[model samples]
Target chain A: MRIEVHLHPPFTQVVGTRTLPVELPDGASLLDLIERLRMDYPNLFPSLRSPEREEEVRSFAIFVGGGEVLPLSYKLREGEVIEIYPPLSGGVVPKLVQKTRRLIC
Target chain B: MNAGYMGKVLFVDLTRRKTWTEPLSEAWARRFIGGSGLGARYLVELSDPGVDPLGPENPLIFMNGPWTATPIPLSGRHEVVAKSPLTGIYGEADAGGHWGTALKKAGYDGVIILGASEEPVYLWIHEEGVEIRDASHLWGLDTYVVDETLRAETAKTAVTCAIGPAGENLVKIAAVMHDGRDARPAARCGLGAVMGAKKLKAIVAMGNRRPPIHDRDGLMASIKAAVPEIKRLAESLSKYGTSGRMTTIEALGDLPIRNWVQGAWKEGAERISGQRMAETILKKQYFCGACVIGCGRDVEITQGPYAGVQGAGPEYEALACLGALTVVDDLEALAYATELCNRLGLDVISTGGVIAFAIECAERGLLPAKVDGIELRWGSPEVVLALIKQIAHRQGLGALLAEGVRKASEDIGGLALEFAIHAKGLELPAHDPRAYNSLAVGYATSNRGACHLQGFSYIFERAVTLPELGYPEIQDRFGVEGKGRFVAVTQDLMCLFDSLKTCKFILFGGIKPTHLLAWFNLVNGWGWDLDRFMEAGERIFNLKRLYNVACGISRKDDTIAPRILTQRRGEGGAATNLPPFGEILSQYYEHRGWSPEGIPTEETVRRLGLEEEAGKLRAKAVMKV
Candidate 1:
């Protein structure tokens, strides 16, 4: 089977990639794939594993595609594109700031 | 007729113990407006061509722009200008809080502080008058305490700008923290040290007089029209906070890791991002005066190792430099270090960079006999925290590091100094200029050393578009093409914002060029249009450049350190991307109409109405020599 991944404002850089076969024993978790990806991308996983304090690793978030995913074991189909977008910033730019008045009001 | 302005310039000479207010002249306001322009005009007049930055001759002026306290979005801001200890040139840092508003309320347009105080004191401004209060007891306290004690003791919630231990110690990178809690820093140019050297603890202002408005009804209606556009942008900010950028910055490989060793932080960036904060630690939110967007995150550490240790919490830069850059993942440690900088009255960016540089030096075996066996190991959160305390007090190895990155690197010696990412003696902020090419120029040519806010090219490079007003499409972040054009345009715009004392976020919020024009027209009753406003911005930029030129900095000096220019991030999204500094700088020189060596050309001087002053300056130079 195959999967499609979505990129925002998608144009430049890598569009998508074909991943390894998704044949897991019975009901392997999504975390299993992430664990696999962790092995695949060591640099990406560097911050996640605190060599000094293992407990600090708990702060990270994993997003599949664009939104939150089910637990890691929530298995993925063969071609599903998994986006392990780590603890990305939300309110990314605009938040509690001075505002312009509403035109309608 | 000064219609919308306070119509006076308040002058305070601490050395002579004299205070006076000068009625505003029509020409000055018409040309310079407020904030950066007024700041530059004032600084140019006060500073000698070759005056020592640390000497008493430096003038620290605080200014507000036309839109400052008006009903415009993010207008609660002001500027501080002095000859910078960091840059050995013109120094300026703009801050946002209620202080700018209070200055207006006190029936003054701007305040120029010159000379030095004989003893430790603070200036108190109420609606009625100004008083020099004894600040002997408040002298050694941290900014938090100074702010709290002033409010408690004086019965006034006066917005205060106070120097911490670093400033009092005359650290070159010391910052003047405004309002105390927001960390709304006038955090560049080492202006805080100027405050400290004056033996001044703080300036507390709370006044009730309203600034006269020309088109009050029209302005109010315009302001009403702006409120919703503001709310839409601010709503996200209030929810996410500024730290919300950590993970994304980390993801983009923009986060500075290990003194800019890598683009991505190894210490899980997402873990410290806003989502994690909201889920794990965030408690309440905070805001400045009339500020709709409250990016201040109040956090509570619970159920973790750092649990129960509570403070305002660590922002992104701290998390980057102290955390990932130092290889420390303890959020508690990051928060503690940030609080320590606040306590010690230090610039967090400079302080963090200092520690990171020290770590690199220590790892490189540059620690000498003076280090007293202190381990400068990278990523050692405990030691990093301890050193932060030490730097504040200038104790042991901390004493050496407290001298800032340049002197510290000089003392440490070896290849370690090469890795020190500094421009104009001040350590660069958390952003790796190497990753963001335009930032290289920003860091190099900033009025204050190594400031990101001064140029703010990152916002443009990172998909922020203001295309409705016809800004060119932000070039590729990794590309150096059109960067000079980008930097020149952005620098002028920043000058405008800095002078206007408006939040940088206002640009992102679609405040429109027309809004600023209207505000300017309303305040000074100047018939100035948008082109004139932009020209004022350009004039201020060149004026600041002239100050640097007078201080003897040349094109040769406008450059990033070897490491930032040559080294590429070893890992992360920005791997293999190095700033095309030389190319961009050449373009920048061309854009500014400067000589290849960075001197302002005669043509530019004439075009900008600086030709008359240029002749006078040349005549003065010959006379002095």
Candidate 2:
């Protein structure tokens, strides 16, 4: 089965493309696809999964076709399109200041 | 003396041209916790329930909370409360900018203005005192010019909260603009019209005083420990501001499109998104005073047809309302329109709602093909821009729209109310109830009408979790179980946020009830536990509801538009969910301890120590009977 993945920034920056195609076994769970992406894109995996807690996915939201937020156990089928977004925090000072602090520290 | 308060409230009578200072009541502060809560308490005591909102009897209040102007992150906000000319009920609005901080520094916790000035005037508040000066020249000016001219005439460091032609003309959708070009607005409930009716042009605050702190070192240490995590959690917001969530919001079916009749507008959503703004006209990020997450955008359109359209870029609400709701996909044009609304001191959400409502009326032939010499068509940038000016100046068809959607639709008559899209007279914010089941109940029971911020229960349904409120994980947006209890709890929590004048975005930074309690205790030297803190919130919410009940609001009035309740998008993320609204509302009433008619029960009033308010309600009920 083939699945289409749409990534928003900063994931797009990490993966170097907004959309990508992946092949998966029939009746594959959503977690299986995440595992596949983790192995395929090592640099992007850190953002998808927590660095400190490997088993825990980061707070980034994932929506299936028509914006349904299904669980990881949900089965994926042929021609499924998945959209991923960064955490919607809705403000600016904290991020820029944090980035600067990271560089300094 | 309270450590975090100035312990003084300034009372000005415009009719008598008299100003007096009264000691802030410690008992009232303890019960209300300042800002909206305190303002509401004062309003209930000082004015009757059914006073004309634009008349001299209505009190216009500007209030700050304990956290305001302190070193606490996201504490630079204030609340404006009045009898709404738009809703005719408990009306309040919140804004973030330096104006609140400046007011705090000027050595007052709040200002209450009564009576109307016979002539145009502006109040200059400084370290010395307040002076009611002539502002005849400042009349009829845009907010930008008023701000600049006020600062130039006063201290350069002073900040001004002013109204423009929209407010001057008594436009019901007018906003009270703060920080000049940065343009933070207490932009709902038609409070600006109240300010205009007072013939008060601007409030300029400049001073060097600071409130005494109870535990400065402890507060600083806690803030330092919390800052790193907050910054990390809110990094995306800092990068893209609030408009960053446009694509995701659209994907989730939360974005209102084509006056909320359309299910999806994928390509159109992307064009007006924050990412698109960053890629195009975003010049820099703007920040309110003491904000750790500066989720404000500063944009400059230096070279387009929108050249000279600079400062205070549109946020998520503006983008959705002015862009998607109208089906206007032109980003540059929308940016210009947003700027124009700010200049004219209009509420973008209400302005967009009225314009979108007018377009639908025209499409159905309920209105003439051309209004005020401009063709009324959806997606026409010129129409949107022209309508904004018309509404602000109250000229032509703009005169009707200036009354806001509810009244305008009533005047238009016949099936127009079906498209009015408001709750208790105030236009709905950009978020649709279909997207989140909780929003339906949240909007309906909100004391100040269909305000998302009043509850913000949708945040828990989307990203954040409130472990303190028993949600260790995100609640199911489509689930019906326990949602009534959930909405009630979150509304109480949000009341604390508003009363404290802290930005709600702190929740996105992982700030919990415990953190908020700790900060409150530290700042005020109060030994309040989590339960006690939450009880205060409940008391505040109930008091406001009691005020509304006195104003003749009942369970029948606690409703949203019929269109929103009955219609489904039928094709998006929220397509099939209609929100079992009746069930949720029943559960909400039970959780809130209110009667089936949505009135606070006698037992509830006793529990919350609101017998005084309940007495008022009983008196009114007896009079009616």
Index of the highest-lDDT prediction: 2
RMSDs, each prediction? 8.4, 3.7
Top-TM-score structure, candidate number? 2
**Candidate 2, pairs of clashing residues:** A91-B237, A91-B238, A91-B295, A92-B238, A92-B294, A92-B295, A93-B293, A93-B294, A94-B292, A94-B293
As a whole number from 0 to 100, the lDDT of residue B62 in candidate 1 is 87
In the range B1-625, model 1's lDDT, one tens digit per residue, is 4665677888889998888888876676666667888877777766675666667788888887767667666778888888777667778877777878887777777888888887898888777788888899987888888888887766465677788878888877788887766556777767888888888888888877777777677567666666655554444356666676565566566777877775565346755666566666777776655666666777766665555545566767667767877777766667767777766677777778888887777676676422655666766777777778788777778778777788778876777679877887877777767557789988887766677877887766653443433553434667776788778877887888887667776544445555666666655566776678888888878877776776677777787678888887766667777888889989999988999988889889878887655554554331221
lDDT of 2 by residue, B30-126 (tens): 9999999999999987888878999999999999999999999999999999999999898999999899999999999999999999899999999
Q: TM-score of model 1 relative to the true fold?
A: 0.84
On DockQ, the leading prediction is: 2
